[model samples]
Structure formats: C-alpha cells, structure tokens
Target: MSMNGREKITNKKRLKPAKIVWQVIVYLLLITGAIVMLIPFFWMLSTSLKESFQVFSFPPKWIPDPIKWDNYVLTFNSLPFGKWLVNTVIITASTIVGTLLSCTIVAYGFARFRARGRNVLFLVMLATMMLPSAVTMIPVFYLFKSLGWINTFYPLIVPAFFGNAFFIFLLRQFYMSIPTELEDAAKIDGLGTVGILWRIIVPLTMPALTTVAIFQFNGAWNDFMGPLLYLSKPDLYTLALGINFFKSQNDVQWNYLMAASLVTMLPSLILFFVGQKYFIEGISLSGGIKG
Candidate 1:
C-alpha cells in the first residue's frame, strides 16, 4: 500500500476513538440530566406510599418498607377524586374540541382568504398573545359573572370556542406550510373550498392538529386559576383544585396529596407519550415557509 494510504488509515483510526469518546460523554451527560429530572418524581412516588410518619423519617427511605398502597384508595375515599376526574375530563374534552374546531377554522380563513387588511388583522391577532391573561382577568370575570357562568363549566369550557391567539397562530403557520398545489388540484377535481379543507388540508395537517389538541388538553387539564376563579362549588371543582382537599388550616395530608397528584398527572403523561411523535413532527413542519 502507498505511504499516503497508510497515513489516511492511521488518521481514521485516531479520529474514531475521539468520536466514540465524544458520544460517550454526551450520553453520560444526558443520562445524568435524566436522573436529576426523575429524582423529584421518584421522591413523590416514594412519599405517596409511605405512612405519614414515615414521610419525614430521618435518613429518608427511597423505598417505603411498608408500602401504603392504601393511600391511593384513601385519596379517593377521603376526597371526591372520581367526581373531580370526571369534571376535569369533561372540561378538557370540551375545550379540546372547541379549540381545535375554532382555531383551525379561523386559521384556515386567515391562511386561505385574501381579504383587506389581512396582514394587519393577522398581526393584531398575534399581538393578543403578548397580553397576559391576568390583564383581562377582572373584565372576563365580570362578563362571566353577568352571564351567570360563575360556578359552572361554561366559564371553563365556552371561551375556548372563541379561538385562542396562540392556537390560531400555530394552526395558521401549519396551514400555510401546506402546498397550494394540493388545494388547486382538488379544486380542479370539482372540490369546493370546504371540501378541499376537509379532505386535503385536514389529513395533511393531522400532526399539527394533534399538537394543538395535546397542548389544549394539557392546559385545560392543569388549569387551576380558571376553575378557582369560576368554580366556587366543591362538587364542580376540576382535579387541579380538587386536590387541595387534602390541605386545611391545621393539617395537610402529604401522602394522600402526593397520591392524588400522581393520579392527576397520569392522563397528561399518557397523552404526551401517545402524541409525542405527531407533536414533534407538527412543530417541525409548522414553520415550513414563514409567511
């Protein structure tokens, strides 16, 4: 073999170890971070299964020797966890449906229609996202109060039908990313605008739509302030607020609280795992061609 060939082989051999070392370091870092992130969750799980006394035991036990699985059962019995779960599910599902339908329709209009001051309107809509919910809290509360929606699911579920700015932006970005050729072809085949949207755009943007659903579902599931503001009745409380049943002026049931928290967290965790693939894909394609 030529000397140049020998030199190239030697350089390749030297570079391979450096690449492997770099990968190993990266993996180690990722693993360390993952462990760190998981520690609090592990602690929560541990505490949930421990007796009240065991929870603050000196030299804290990572593994509850006498696992109190009864804490979960006790949580349900002690609080109306089942009712809270049902209420939360109802609110979340309604909000998801409302958000998806409202945002997508509005987004489609914004993306497909060529109306006057379209850009200005779009900018104005996007600008709403900059305003904090706290800014309009009082006015919205009075509006709902006037409508007698306070202490009812209407305050929680109805406003989602109006289309959220962030959701509209997300859907609009994804809708714009779709190729106009597809719509044009559908039109040539005697499809109407709504037909094109329903058949062509909807299927193509499932990932983005799934992302929106996941986000809205998560937000609704975890919304504490909204339910707290509108739902004064214990029976109407969502799980986020219902979990506070474990707290009182004198005592807090830490174990039951943790157990209930784990239960409340499960749906969101499951949904994220199920939709993560689509969620990632949608976000990646959402900005395909920034308009």
Candidate 2:
C-alpha cells in the first residue's frame, strides 16, 4: 500500500474507537434518562396495586405481594369519578373544536391576507403570550362573573372560542410554510378565499391542526385552576378537581389517589402516542417556516 493509504487507515482505526466510545456514552445517558422518567410512573402503578400499609413500608416494595386491585373499584364507588369524566370530556371536546375553528381562521388570515397594519397586529397578538396568566386571571374572572359565567362550564369552554396566541402562532407559521402556488391554483379553479382555505390550506396543514387539537385537549383535561375557579358544583367538577376527593382532614387514601391519578393520565398519554407523528411534523414545519 502507498504511504498515504497507510496513514489514512491508521487515522480510521484511531477514530473508530473514539466514535464507539461516544456512542456507548450516548446510549448509557439515554438509558439513564429513560429509567429516571419511568420510575415515578412505576411507583404510581406499584402503589396503586399495593395495600395502604405496603405503600410506605421500609425499603419500598417495587411490587405488591397481595395486589389490591380493588383500589380502582373502591375509588370509583367512593367518588363521582364517572360524572367527572363526562364533564371533562365535554369541556375538552368543546375546547378542541373551538380552538380548531377559531385558530384556523385567525392563522389563515394572518398567514395569507395582506393589510396595512397586519404585521403590527400580529406582533401585538404575539406579545400577549409574554404576559403572565396570573396578571390577567383576576380581571378575566371579574369579567366572567359580570357575565354570570361563574359556577358554570361557560367560563371554561367559552374562552376557547376566542383563540389562543400560541396555537395561532403555530398554525400561522405552518400555514406560511405551505406553497402560495397551491392557493393560486385553487383560485384559478374558481375557489373563493374561504373555499381555498378550507379545501387547499386546511388539507395541507392537517399535521398542524392535529397538534393544536392535542394541545387544547391536554390543556382542558389537565386544567385544575380553571375548573376550580369557575366550577363550584360537584357535578361540574372535572377529573382534575375530582381527584381531590381522596383527601380528607382525617386520612388520605394514598392507593386510591394513585389509582385515580393513573386513570386520569391515561387519556392524555394515549392521545400523545396516537397523534405523535403529526405533532412532531407540525412542530418541525412551524419552526422551519419564515416570513
């Protein structure tokens, strides 16, 4: 072999071990992170299956010896879990529908339409996201109270119809990423602006819409403060609020609480897994797009 060939081979040999070592280190770090993330869930599951006494036992049992599966049954019987589930479903479904309808229109306009102050208006809208929720909470609550929306689902579901800044920004960026040629083609086919948006833009931006739906669903489902502030009647309580039934001044049902929490989290977990592909694609498109 030539001297140059011999030198290249030596360099490759030296680099191979270094690359392997880096790969091993990466894999080890990933595994460690996976374990750390999963430990709490595993503990929740273990506690849900164990007798109350086994939960705080020394050395911490990773598995239940007797496996008290009745914790779930008892939890349901002891609380209004079914009613809470229905209320949550209603709020989440309504919020997703409202968010999609309102955000899509607002984003489509921001993405496609031209006006003198459009850019200025868009900047103002984005600025609202920087304001803390706490800053607006009291005023918003007072406004809802003035409208007699307090102690009702209206306060929770109605605000969603107004659209959110983050979802609008996400959908707008993704919409901007779509080729303008598609809109021109639709227009040449005699489609109006709204028709073009529905037929061309919407179909092309399904991933972004799915991302919005998933986010709104997760938000409404996990919202404790909104439900607590707006909903006073027990019948109107969401699963997030209903979970507190396990708490009392005298005693807290740890096993039942864990079981209920796991059950409540299942829907969000399933939703993310089901829409994960579109969610990731939407995020990539939204981030990659520019004015």
The best candidate by TM-score is: 1
Model 2, span 14-133: residue lDDT tens:
999999999999999999999999999999999999998988999999989999989999989988999999999999999999999999999999998998999999999999999999
Q: Which parts of model 2 have CA positions greater than 4 angstroms off?
A: 279-291
Compute each candidate's TM-score over C-alphas.
Answer: 0.94, 0.93
Q: Candidate 1 residues 199-269, lDDT tens each?
A: 88887777788888988998999999999899988999899998764565257779888998988898888
Could you tell me which 10 consecutive residues in candidate 1 have the lowest summed lDDT? 282-291
Clashes of 2: 0
Query: Candidate 1 at 110: error in angstroms?
Result: 1.3
Q: How many residue pairs clash per model?
A: 0, 0
lDDT of 2: 0.89
